[model samples]
Each structure stands twice: as structure tokens, then as C-alpha cells.
Target: MNTTHPAKDLQVLAESLASVAKVTKNLDVLIFGAGLGGLAMLEVLSQSEHVSIHSIIDISEDAPAFQLAHELGVNTSTDSSAELESFRGDIIIDVTGDASLRSKLIAFKREHQVELISAKSAKLLFDMANQELRSERTIETQNSRLSLLDCMLEITLQLESRPPIHDITSRSFADIHSHVHAISGLALIFDKQSKAPQCVGAIGENAPDCSEIESCQSCNGIILDACSRLSQKERYKLFKPSIQIKCQAIENCYNVALPLWQDTRLSGVLLFDIQAPLSKEQKTTLKMASVHLNMTFKTLDHFQQLEEMAIFDALTGVFNRRKFDMQLHQEVSRIKRMKNGTLTCGFIDLDDFKQINDTYGHQTGDLVLKHIATSIESCIRDYDLCARYGGDEFVILLPSDDAMQGSCLERIGMRILEKVANFDLVNAPEIKTSVSIGLVTQSGETAHAETLLKKADEALYEAKKSGKGCLRIFADEQFHYTPSKE
Candidate 1:
């Protein structure tokens, strides 16, 4: 029920429930997890007359989800999510985020080989419900006044730009005799291996029709001349100069074409049949879509590059100081908010960096900097962030357990000493890069941001003084007025 109309969708859902009503016996719907999404479904099902809830199952007896389910006058139980699948129902909705549960459910389905020949109605209801649930979440993100005309224009622009398409097909392409309006559509894309574009994604009406790619054709009659231009050799040789006008989908059918991209390569193109001519206003949205899409591509490319660069020092393509400052602040905030998440921070300096530049040369020092950055990044987690502080100094923000009750900072300090100073460096593994770290944490009333930052710097300075390559923290936790050290 991927329908635009609320009334029609509800009716289809009701009909689906009715078809299952005969065998939908003991009609108790079971939700594996009574979290927000589960409860949302439960609310809709409660209004549906064909089914009743068996139970809302969750591991937590006190989970807020269970509480909400109970308040709705629904049956509830505190058991593992496994028990829900066994209950009688044509459809079972799984909402838990647990991966193990998913594996178990998939295994159960295979083990039982549960297949129904007449699942059309049941499947419809299931699909409709899921659509509605997901649609609810989009309440805040979209303001599009979607229409058939709008669909046509968007399709035209998509085809013109030849964008690497996600969802559309040529089979759904309808040859237009006049201005057509308000038609449901699907867009499909095909790769070099695909005979025709397969419907990978769609918005309305089209479905199961595109189980295969070869099914994507306008009719028994396709413009052969246009089709040949799609050849790799032809495409590479600016088949565009002449083929652009003739080499398109469905001469008689109304549809658009688009290319797909992966890295710098073209994966495939998509085709859309809006089934009718589009008004200029609707075409405007399509043009806007082009501009929006261009921006999206640039943003994605830039982010990919930035992420790679983030692993190094910016000036020297090594881990830069920016990452260190960020990690310190995040860990400090995490510690302030929860007892379980505590972290430590430290700053390190290359002993006599100026002397090294003067005697050994700045080039040698730069090589050392790159080696240090590599070592730090290799030691951290995907979740962990590391950066060079500046010049010859680097910083580390490490997570640690609060082993000594309130001195979480000390635990993190111990870990860093072992992780960085003790581990092998990148290039100079033997004459390794060593660091002095100042570590600190705000475990109590020291929740203010400025205090936490100041305390961390103070601890860093103490490490610089207590001989290089060592760790230190402020003796007292409440060093509120400690001056910033950066």
C-alpha cells in the first residue's frame, strides 16, 4: 500500500487484514520489541479490527517501551525477543535493533520453510503498514507537494542529466498521446550486464513487474539505432554528438533516462516513464532537482576526501591538531553526562624541536611528524579521533574505565602510556616518537565545558614538566580556575 491516498491505503490494509482474518486465528499480533516503532505499529493495529495483540515482548521488564505498551491496555511480557515468532500470525513485525535476533529469525524461517501460496492480501497489509510507519518519521523532513505532473517533470530532468539512477524502469514508460496527469510510476537502472534496466527503486504503482532487467522495454519495438549507441565502444567515442537525440528509451513511450555512478566510473543508467507530457512549472522542479543533485555529488566527494585527510597531519598530511581538540571536548562531555563513559587527554612535545630543525633539518623533522601521525591513527578506533596538536607536539584522547572510583582520568592515563609510548612507531620503529601527556577528567560537579578544558591543559603542562614522555593529572579534581594551556 505505497499509496498517496490515505483512505485507499487504509481500505487496502483493511482488506488484507480481512483476507487473513479466516486463518489469522487467535489474532494476536506480537511485537518483538516494544520500542517507539513497535508501539507505533501496535497503535495502528489496535485500530484495525482483524487482529488482537498476543503480547509485546522485550528483554527489559522495566524498559520504557513495555510501560508504554501496557498503558495502551495491551498485553505485555518480559521475555527475550525469540518467543514472539512462534505465535500465530500471517505476518510478524520485528522492531528490535538486535542483530542476533535477526539471525535467529532468518534461521527459523529457513528451517520451517514457511511459504504461503496465497499471501497477496497478507503481504499487502504488511507492506502498507511498514510504509505508513516509515512515512510518519518523514513528517519533519519533506514538504514536497508530490503530483503526477511533478513526477513527469522530475523524470524528464533525470533522463536529461543522465544521472546515475537509483530507481526507475523503462517498462513503466508509457507512450504519451496527449498531456497525461496523476499516474503512478517506477524508475529502473541497468548496468553493462543488464539487458534492460531493472526496477531497483520506485515511488508508486509499479512493482514485482521488474523482477528482472530484460523486462525493461517500451514494446516489442525498440529503436535499434538508439540501442546500439549504448555499446561501450560507442559510448566512449562521443556517441553523444549524434546519438544524444536518437539514442534514448521508448520512442513512442514517455520516459526519461539517467546514468549511475560509482567513484569515477559509470555503473548504469535509469529510465522513467511518466506516461504524459509535463507542464513547464513541474519541469522547473526537475531543473531544481538537477542543481540539488549536483550539490549532493560534490558534497559526497568532498567528504570522502576530508575523511581520508582527517587521518593525517594537515600541514604534513599527518594527524593534525584539529582532531585532538575535537576528541578532547567529546570525551570530556561524555564523562560529564554519564559515569560509564570516561576519558583522558594528553599533549606531547618533541624534545627540542627547534634544535632538531636547526641541526637535523626541518625535512627530517617533517618525516618524523608523519611517522608519529601514522602510529597514533593505527592505534585508535574508528570511533576514536586523534590529531597533531601543532609543531612537533601531538595529542591523544583515550577512553578508560573508572577503575579507581572517581579518578577515571588516571585509568585513561595508564592506557595511553602503554598504547603510544610503548608501541612501535611508523617509520622510525626503533628510535620511536615519544610523548608527554597531561590527562584530566571531570567526574563530579565539574560539568562546565570551560572547566573541563582548562583542567585538561593544566594536566598536560604538568606532564611536560615531570620529564617528557610521562603522564600526569591535576592532584585535585576541582581545579575550576585553572588557566588554559594551549
Candidate 2:
């Protein structure tokens, strides 16, 4: 039988479930009912890391537990009477509160010693969710008016990637909206340079039309067209601190316009007036919002940097084999679309890296890899790609518009010889490490990125046979292998 639930509800349920699942890696779970609450618990369990949400049980195969579990990528089926010994769950949650299932688990405990969490225990998760939200809203033990941007940042923190957005949005809608108004009744974003406010996604009443701040025409007769037209530094002199902005969006917007500056350009304005002018607590909100935004952006940027680092060899700081595959897929799409794009790839393997590791220990061997990475980074252009393709293997890509990839590879090979010769390993004994390079290029789309990588790999093997520190280019023969993204 086909079961039904609102899509929004399902999405929110899924997300929340994913969040819970991320907390643990192992789950021997036997759930009964497959109803809303049961699916929610299951969703939380499956999205978790190291935890596998075992099958959920209910009488009907098409029940919410069965359907939602499939969506969450879990193995699921239905059972009328779930037996603890016969089933594969570490802990069984009796969502149905069915005495039979509970009895089964209790009986098992007497004979085999089993631990179980009741359906009632799930309520703790909701309490935890509330605390997370409260912490996000609180600003250093002070109160303040919140901007929309600040609210968005806090919302992100409150949620882990586990919950599907749909589930979290619906479940937390009222709380989220109320939280929004509590921060700012109407948050406005305006462009500081041009004095234009644009309407991005907004929660309160004061939301405007455009996504950026435009000239404030609210009660305006005079238009402040550009940053050059007014000076924010001297404007404070006239209004005795009431002039919060020295530069104006002209005069009408002075009461509520909060400038958002990023990189010296007006990203937008976060404007709000609150109910009774501005309370000190409300004022603190703006300060906190700004602080949080700066940190949030930095955190996001850092996550990206860390992701890039993950694909790198610890010593070499280059893309690993996993990254090569991802990059190859992207390049394949690029070449498929254009039909004519520069695609140059190379594979380089360090000669005697293992011997060096065996002789001087991994510490000195690491230094050699570090020095090689630095040398390679300096020689490659900004557009050229570089990555550690696992072990002592390295790969590089040059998508040039005009320069010959062969010529470029030759120059890099000679430079590596020179760089390797001038060895300085920080007081460690002098050691030698060299790279065998293989290069491949295509001016037009004839093969996929995987094929190119294969050719490059084969060429590198040929390079090793020819000599340890030489370069080889792909010729008529082509091989196929998927490369990782860098």
C-alpha cells in the first residue's frame, strides 16, 4: 500500500534525522510503526557518520518508515513482530510503544544483555535543537537587534549538513520566523557605494524590492547618487552622533540604514528601526551580527581551503588521486561544451623516494617532498593545475591558449633539475630526489579527461624506463583511466 505525507514535512523530517545520524557511526536499530516520529528518528540515524541505520520495521511495506528510509539511502523492509536476536539492531526504539516489541527487547536483555532507547527518549533531540538556536542568537551575554545576514549565519550553525533543508525548514518555520522578527522586524540590505538597497530573501515587513541598496527615496527630495557626492567622516559633525553614516544614501534613510561593507565596497545595507527607536540590547545585535558575518565568511573560506588541502599530499601539498578524478570530470565537461579547449596534463613520479625514506627516515624524505612541492608551485602558472597523485606521484595540468604544453613541460623539467641540485633541508644531511615527468595535451576535444590521464600515466612509465628525471609526452597510443579532481 502507498503511504502519503506532505513533501515539505518529509524533507524537514529527513534533514533532522540526518543531523542525529551524523553524531554516531554504528546503529543496530529496530523501529516499529514507520509513522512520522519513527521516520524522524530513522532519518537522524542514517545521516550520521560511522553509523549505519539498520532496517526499520512496520506492518505495511509502503509505510512512512519504508519510503523515507529508501530516500535516506538505507536498507529497509517491514516486519510484524521484530525479534531482537533475529534482527540486526544494536538498540531498538519502540516508537509504537507496542508491548510486544518492548517485551522482546526486555526478554533479550535478561538472556543476552541488550541496551535500548525508548521512543520517549527522542524528545531530548528537540530540546537540544532549541538550545542550539538560543546559543546562536545570544551575543556575548548581551541583547541586540539582528540583521537578516546575521540570522542566516546563525541558522546555518544551528543546522548540520545531515538534515535535508526541507525537513528543517518546515519543522523550524515558526521558530525561525519568530527568531527573525526578534532580531529585526524588517531587515534591509543596501549598496553603500551607490546608495541602492536590494531585496534578497527577507523575513520581516520592511523588506524592499531590489537585492542591493538603491537611493533611499522614502521621503527624499535630494538624491545621493554616489560615494563621491558625500563624506561620512564630516557628516557626524552636523547631527551630533545621530548621523550614524557620514556618507549618505541621501538624507531620508538615516534613521534605519546599517551599512554592510565587504572588501571596501558596499556589499549592502542591513537596515532596521526596531519598535521603540533603538534599545542598547538591540544595538548590540547589530554589532554581534557584523562580527558573526565576518567570522562566518572566514569559516566558509577556510572550509574550502581545507577541502583543497585534503586532496594534497601532506608533504607535497598537491592534489591527490581522488582530486585528479574530479578535475578530469570537470575538464571533460568543458571540452565537451567547447569542442576546442587547451587540455594539457602531466604525471610525475619521484625517483628513489622510497630509497630516501628507507635510508634517512620518513622525516627527511618528507622534507624532500616539501621542497619539490615548493619548486613545482613556483614554476606553474596560476591557471595551471598541480596535485599530489598519491605516494610519490604528482600531476599537473596546463590549459594554455597559445603556449605549447611540450615547451612548457620541458622548461619545468629543466627548472626541477636546477631546483633539486640546490638542496637545503634545514641542517639535515644533503639528499637527492628527482621526478620523472609525463605530459599530454590536446588542442581539440578528441578524448575524455580520463583518457588523457591514462595516456599521461603511461607516458610517465615510459619516462621512468628512459631515465629517472626526464619527461615524456603522449603520442598515438591512448589509454583510459578516470582522474581525480584537484
Candidate 3:
């Protein structure tokens, strides 16, 4: 009545088999079609706690997912049937959305004991895995944003430590260079009086070199060329915000120019090359950094003006005696390094200056000195040094190569005479002021600044003796005075 004999043993054996079947096994999954969905399923299966992906199959070797599979070292094939027959996998997933292949695989599964998943079923698996991955990526992106924010805060603190203006700019540029993905950058400040852009800093390849910001015009042409392209409407937009210039030279890079303003004046420009169409976070960071750069450039410009006031003559707007001595020493050192250096020093004294001062007040004398300074500046090259040596006397340093033959000096003397002869002043009579110039051309690297100045002074005395308006060229310790026919 209680089912005795082997019936109980048979029931126990059946229960044991069911329990064994319930235990999960790690299945070898072979993914068909190395497409986006196929790759996605392969990744999911590989990371699963109960399944493993062993191989991938795609007809084209150059598919994106195929390349990824190769990089991951997953066994791959250009033929699907070979892998399907050879692998004898626990499961084969068809994600190519090929209906013909799906029908063939279904028939093959009917004959073989192996399981096969249709493309539609594979899509479901891929979708579920993709949702989970998106959630994880969202968290990762937020963490990245936080980390970048921390870096920004650190950079802001560094900028606020009150270092030298140049140091501040250099440090700021270095920080940007590290954080921003860019090719090259140029930082420039505006000279309002000259209406020119002065390069303050540069980073990366082919960057402009402008050690002295005030006198350098290397970036002027570049800035002007950019400005010329901007319309009035675009220029107005710069008042409110920055602008991006498309650089045809660099692929996928934009020239970002941030305008710096102080009390309605365009104080400077912070320019850099970056991949265009910036993200929201990157745009915000750039705007904030630009604000800091504007402050730094404004402060630097103030200090630069003060430095100029110290080194330049107050009335004549030329180099003072102290600066002249420093420049002469520098040029002398350069000449000594050359094989055969020729340097010409010219001493200029205003003839009948005292009589002119007596006739006209000191105000007119100041005006005359300014006029002479202007004339001297017009006649000399930018590299040549002109300084107000003392009251009513000026000095000039002309450096030349050994092959110059002194023609430049002769031309400069003539030009100065002509400019002085044509001097015109407002609210003053036709009072003519002549200059007695004595020039000493010294060859060989042995000539010192003191010796050259003394020789030029001696020649000045000789020119004064010859006539009122004349030039004397002193060579080989002898003076040769040339009286002006005018």
C-alpha cells in the first residue's frame, strides 16, 4: 500500500537529477556578426557570471566591432559556418538581423543538439545590457566633472596667489595648456596709444617670440588679419563675449579669441587653438579663466607703463643717459663676440641753443627738443639706439657689419640735416636751430664705449670750430669736417 520496493529509490534518483539540472553551468557563447549589437552582446556575455563568449564571426575584417574584437584578443572569423560547425558551442547568438541566416541556424539547431538564438532575441539581450551600461556611464561622467572642477579650483587659487604679472600669465597659460586640448596659443595685450596688439605669452609649436612686449610687432599682422575678417556686427558681439575663428590650416581646430576689457577699453586678447564647438563645461571654464587673464594683463600693463617712465627721458620721450649707458654696454659686448665688428658713435650738440632759449621761453625750448627727438626717431633704424645724452646734447649708437663701408652713417647724417632744416612749429617764428654732429667709426672688436664717446666728443668740438651746421667724421684719430652748403 505504501509503494514499497524500488519505486521509492526511483523517486529519490529523479529528485537528485532535477537538483543537478538546476545548478547553472558556464556556457561557451559564439557571437555571429561583429556589429554594434553583436559586440554589445559579446561584452555582456563575457562579463556575465554564468556565461562566457569564446569567439566572434563577421564577413568583413574591417568592421568597427571586428577591430574591437581583435583588440580584445577574442578569436574571430570571416566565415560564420566554419566557426558554427567547428566550435560546437553551448550557444550561438545571431545579431546580424539576417533572416536567411536565422532560418538556416534554426534548421541547424534542429539537427544538432546545440542551442541557437535568433537576431530578435539577441536584440533584447543587447538592449538590457545597454541600459545597465548607460547607468554606469552616467555615474562616471559625473565623477569626471567633479574631478575637473577640483582641478579648476586649484588653478584659480594658483592664479590668485599674487605673483609677478608675467609669472601669473605664464602659470595661467601652462595650466590651460595642460587642461585644454589645443595645438597652439598666443596671449596678447593691447597698446591703446599705438592701437597695436602686443604678444605677452605663447605656447606650443610655431609660437611667436616676443620677449619685449612693447616694441615687438610680430603678432600685429596676425591680429590685424583676424580683425579685418570680423564684421561690425561680429565686432559688437566681442563686447559681450569671445569669438571663435576657424583656422583652415589646422583641421578641426578653432582659434578662440577672448576679449579682455577694463572700463570699456579692450585691454588685451587671450587667443588659443582648440577643437571647435566646445562643451558647456569647457566654455564656462574658458570664460572664467579669461576674466582672470584680463585682470592680470591690466595689472601688467600698468607696471610696464611705470617702467617706461623710469627708463625714458621725461621731455624728449627718448632713452635717458642711464639707459643709453646700459644699451652701449650691451652693444659693445655683442660687437666683441663678432669676428670683425664696426661700431659708429655720433655726438650731436644743438648749435646756438642757448641763444634760442634766451629768445624763446623754456616752453619753446622744450618744444624744440621734442621736435628734434621726433626727427632723430624718424631717421634711425629700429635696432639703432638714440638717447638724450644730456641737456641740448644727444648720442646715437650705430652697429654695422665689417662690410658696411660707412655709407649708412653718411645717409643718416644727411637725413637728420634735412629733417632739422624743414622743422616747423606752431605759434613760433622762423627761428632756425642747427646741429653740429661728430661721428667716430671704429673698426675691430677692441673699441670700448668710453673711447668711442671721447673721440666723438673731440670731433664735435672740431665741427663746432669749422662752422655752425656741419658734420665731422672722425677716423684713425683724425677729424674730417664736411660743411653743409645750405
Candidate 4:
């Protein structure tokens, strides 16, 4: 019996080893000082699938150690002090070999419940730790990698599809928010010269409704004040024409901003609200989306420039005859589909236009034409359309609910005459001209665009017959010409 009791100590030793093994499983590690030795330790630890490297707290973002950690899908930051303050870990490894860093970690250990391991100590225990912590988490990590790749490819393909600029931006914001679990997000583009921001897209309830938000100075004031208070380093960051605006306190939420640039010009700002600070991978993803958004805006702007050149009059900056023809046809079709409305057309001819050019130089004639264009444009309602029909001729279209009323047309005609008469062209003192305007209203559903134009032209011919500087109508109630008093 005494001989059998002698081996009882071996059984007690086995129980102690099992307890240590249980504690080594599923470690959450926060490694400090991403230097040479630190990266070596990271590579060694990364092999143990049960050990999740939560983050690396390092001041040197460009260090090889930091790069390796990020490539391995670990979160990283330069805010060592802030990170250390909140991080709770099963293991905090210090491989910097710096006395001060070790001292800081030792101090941290006293206030927090963490197992602090130095480089020398890690070397002695790493193998045992790895063996004890082995698990199937390697599969999960691979799945995460595949998921990230899928997201990247999906967004790139969507951007390549060339949707409308606004739709592209809106979809991008929505995708970013969904992936990052953000509360809200917004994208804004500003005019290069005016710096006046236009909100291209918004997502979620907390996202800024730009029209409503910009109207409230209190909300927009915070953003403006931040721009004014930028430091030298902050401004330098923006010198690249882009900066990540971190406004954690502005709206009491975590916000990330990346300034978008097309070449050297500042195109706009892309922003989102994150529940927590963004990881390195998240920032890379955000930047990728922004680059595509910039490209989309450029494509849209180019098309818009081309469209304006095609549809707008070169000299008067109003609609050209071709565009007018298309719009008139569209209006006539609209009138046919509607239950009740009067489509009124007015033809304007400059009185003695040929004589004016013959008396003055052609340049002065051009000036008169410009004056008339400006006056007519100012008198019409925003919804009304006007166009330069021909040389010394203009056409205006007014859609009203009733055909019997021509009061709006009369008022508009009077205003055009008053403005042109009062205008003082310093270069041409002898330039004086009046407009003979003819109006025709069409209410029949079968009315054609050309018919309205022909009637208006005939009325204008009648006005010329009576005398110069008069308004006439080709409706049931005819308008008589009244000569203007000098």
C-alpha cells in the first residue's frame, strides 16, 4: 500500500497542466509597438486560429510591422494612449524592447486585468500556447476574407455600369452604410468657383437633409466653424485636395469624411456615421468607393456640358430653334392629354430691325437683340419657356388653365416694352427699338404646334399693318394697336 501511494504526485501534476490548457484557449491579443520583433511575434501568433489579434497600437503607421498586421486583417491605430485606455484583452504583448513601453504596459497591468507578456517571456511559452489554443477558427477567418473580396468586386462592377451620377452616389452611400452598419451617410459636391455644396445623396434617418439642414444656420455653422479653425497640419492634409474630417463631437457620433478630388480640383466630400471608429480595412474600402464616385461625377458633368451646347442658343443663352421645336411638340402633346388648359403662343418681331441695322452698325443691332432677349426672359414665369425663333424674332409659350383670359400675356408684353425702353446702353446711345407682339390661344385637344405658330405670326403681321410698336391678338376678342408716346 505504501508503494502505491508514492506515484500519487504524478496524477496531481496532470490536473494542474489541464487547468493551464483551458486558460490558453481563445485569447484576445492587443500587441504594442509594431517593430521588427513585434511583427515576428504577430506572424507566429497569427498561425494560432484560436487567438484573435484584436488590434495593434503603434505610433508608426508606415512601419513594416504595422503593414503586416493590416495585411493580416488586424485593426490598427496611431492613438496608442487612447487605445490602451479602453482595450481589454486576455493577453497584451510588448515586443518593442523599449524600456518606456514595457514600463507603460506594466503600469497598465496594475489597473486592468490582463496577462502581460514580454518578448522574452513570449518566446519561452509561445509553442505551448499555440498547441493549447488550436481551433477551427481558421475557416471563419478565410470566410471573412472571401466576404470582403466579394464586396469590393460588387461595388466596382456597379460603378462601371454608368448609372446617373446621383443614383451612383446614392447607391454607394447605401452600400457603405450596410456593410459598416452605420446609422447614416451623405455625399456632397460643390461648385469649384462658388464652393456652394450640393448634396448628391443621403441615406438613413439621421442623414442630413441638405435643403433643410443648410437652411438652419446652427447646424451648418458647426461645419463651417470647423473649416475655419483648421490647423497648419490639418490644412496640409487638405493640400492634397482631400482630408478625412473627423467630427466626433459635432453631432455626438463617430463620423468619417473623405474629400473627393478630380485631378487637382476639389469635387466634393463623402461622409458617413460609424458607431465605432473605422478600422484600417474599412478606411481602404471607403476610399475605394470615393474614387469611383468622383469618376461618376466627371462623366455626368461632361455629358451635361455637351447637352447645354446642343440645346442652348449660342448668342442669347436661351433655347435655340431646334430645342424650341421639340419642346413645342411636347407641349402640344401634353395639352391633348390634359382635361383642361389653354396653350398660348406669342410671336415677337423687332420693329424696324433692318432699318436699325442700316442706320447703326451691326454691332449695335446685336446689342438691341440682346436687350430684347434679356427683357423677355425677365418677364416670363419660371415654368414658361422662351426661345430665339429666328433673326429679330422670338417665341414665348404660356400654358394656362383658361383660354378666355389673356391678362398675364398683356402684363408680360407691357413689362417687356417698359424694360427695353428704360434700358440705357452706354455704347449705343442712338439705339431705340420696340417689339410688335402677336398672341394666339389654343384650347382644342386636336390643335397642332404649327397651327398655333401660324396664327401668332398672322396676328404679328396685322400688328405691323396697323403701325410699329403694338400688341395684337388673333382670338375672338381682338387687340388694337396703340402707338407709344415719345
Give the best candidate by TM-score. Answer: 4
TM-score of 3: 0.51
Candidate 1 residues lying further than 4 Å off, grouped into runs, are: 1-200, 203-256, 260-269, 273-292, 299-334, 339-343, 398-432, 475-486
The C-alpha local distance difference test score for the whole of candidate 1 amounts to: 0.50
Candidate ranking under lDDT, highest first, comes to 3, 4, 2, 1
TM-score, one value per model: 0.41, 0.43, 0.51, 0.59
Looking at model 1, residue 139 earns an lDDT score of: 48
Q: What is the lDDT of residue 271 in candidate 1?
A: 36
Error of 4 at 483 (Å): 4.9
Q: Give residue 241's error in model 1 in angstroms.
A: 20
* lDDT digits (tens) for residues 135-165 of candidate 4: 3444544454466556645655664454554
In terms of lDDT, model 4 sits at 0.67
Q: Root-mean-square deviation of each candidate, in angstroms? A: 27.4, 26.4, 13.0, 13.2
The stretch of ten residues in a row with the least summed lDDT in candidate 1 is 171-180
Q: What lDDT is reached at residue 260 by model 4?
A: 58
Q: Model 2: per-residue lDDT, tens digit, 1-486?
A: 213334544454446456555655465666656887777677665654645556677777777777777877766656544444476445556677767677776776567543455555543542354465457646533332434445565556754443333232333332333432433322333344554544443334443333223344541212223222323222111122232222232222233333433434444333332344554544544455555543443454466567767676656766677777787777756755564566778887888898989988988877887777777777788866778777777778776544354555566656655665566666665675677777777655574776788778788887777766666777445522222111
RMSD of 2: 26.4
Task: Write down the lDDT of every candidate, Cα atoms only.
Answer: 0.50, 0.55, 0.69, 0.67
Segments in model 2 whose C-alpha atoms lie over 4 Å from true places: 1-277, 280-306, 309-314, 402-405, 476-486
- The TM-score of predicted model 4 comes to 0.59
